[model samples]
Target: MNTNSNLNYTQTGDYLLPNLTLNQPRKPLGKYGRLRRTYLKEQRPVLYHTMLLNGSLYPHLMEVEQTAENRMQQTMAQLLKQNPVPDKEQNQMAWVQHMNSLKAQAEELVLNELIYS
Candidate 1:
């Protein structure tokens, strides 16, 4: 019996291949996860390969994405609190522009801290 954590491997000739079963359900990667995946692949290939070989790449990426999302939300909330938006009905365009800028600022911070770092 050859196994590693939740995965099982079967030997055929001299090679071993993982036998993945459908009992476990995994969520598909989201926007942040995809971005982090690309960054790891392009910028940190060796670390990415190490995690991939150890069957930890997906989980790690998912964790990073979750953290990034949580951080982004928190940052957005803080930004909103610090600089509250004006009335939406009276000045719809200005409100939209302000909200967009705030969101962009939060996104930049999350990307810099979690994805790029």
Candidate 2:
């Protein structure tokens, strides 16, 4: 009901979701195969947070957050396994970029669920 609160925490007493459209990656994923799987897996916590904030505490909703976190952890593990970094020379910038990208994607996915639900 309060659009200003949804847009900014200072007005709503809650943190506004990240703006993904304004900071999308230069190289978008060509397909949504991996993305969809990750999203579906991670939809749990996001749902939980949304429900919690909305004043409806559903025990079942907690599973959404747990499941999503598990899926994301597993995905990150797989990615790290597939791409090993050198010991002496680390790509700090690349690591930062990747982390930021993942964070943005997660936030976007959660925000999308909240907005739609």
Candidate 3:
């Protein structure tokens, strides 16, 4: 049996099979992470496979999720600053609607820039 770096091999018959395992902790993925995973698996299989083989998929997904969530917050704050909504005390429904619109727009921006791309 031959070994190099972090890989271990088992010999069976005439071939050596390398053992593969993920060293990342079992952390729960956020919504954006799942979305990015689905997009990569379906639309970008080659890149997905490469990342998986190299053991960087989960870390990349986590980074994307965190970045997307932060971007969403920043974008929502900027949008709210530019387009102020009516006070919640004066018009609760209007405030809710405007906030929902901002959230949707921010999500779209994250999806376009991070998940799908």
Candidate 4:
């Protein structure tokens, strides 16, 4: 029983796999992730401030934002469905204004219902 024969080897190339093992716990996010999280928290303090106040709320904030986004998307979809836009160059300006109004209202609603509350 040649046990060595069972093992396969390959020539080393320009790329080499890092000596990482599945048993070893993976490292946390890098600087960029941290920075992005910080930025997002700052942008929506009402929602994300809880993370700073209570570290455990970090995951909760993510869930809150996800739910808020889903609600906004649903509302926007329903509005557009109910009020179909005319696909003409003359109606382009009106379409844009309508979209902007919907977006602003959605933002306010999200902030009030999800974030501030």
Query: What would the TM-score be for candidate 4 when compared with the true structure?
Result: 0.50
lDDT of 3 by residue, 20-78 (tens): 78746478899999999999999999999999988899999999989999999999999
The estimated TM-scores of all candidates read 0.80, 0.35, 0.86, 0.50
Rank by TM-score, highest first. 3, 1, 4, 2
TM-score for candidate 2: 0.35
Best by lDDT: 3
Model 2 over residues 1-117: C-alpha lDDT tens digits? 235434432333575453322322334332232344344446656754564455443332343455555655665666667665444346777777776666566655643553223
* lDDT scores of the candidates, listed in order: 0.86, 0.48, 0.91, 0.60
Provide the lowest-lDDT 10-residue window in model 4.
17-26
Off by over 4 Å in 2: 1-57, 86-90, 102-117
Separate clash counts for every candidate? 0, 5, 0, 0
Determine the backbone clash count of candidate 2: 5
Q: Model 3: how large is the Cα RMSD against the reference?
A: 2.2
- Report residue 80 deviation for candidate 2 (angstroms): 1.2
User: Over the full model, what C-alpha lDDT does candidate 1 score relative to the true structure?
Assistant: 0.86
Candidate order by decreasing lDDT:
3, 1, 4, 2
Best by TM-score: 3
Q: Write the per-residue lDDT of candidate 1 for residues 5-75, one digit (tens) a residue.
A: 77678888998888863322188888888899899999999998887876788888889889988998899
RMSD of each: 3.8, 15.2, 2.2, 12.2
- Candidate 4 ranges with C-alpha deviation above 4 Å: 1-54
Instruction: Find the 10 residues in a row with the least total lDDT in model 1.
Output: 16-25
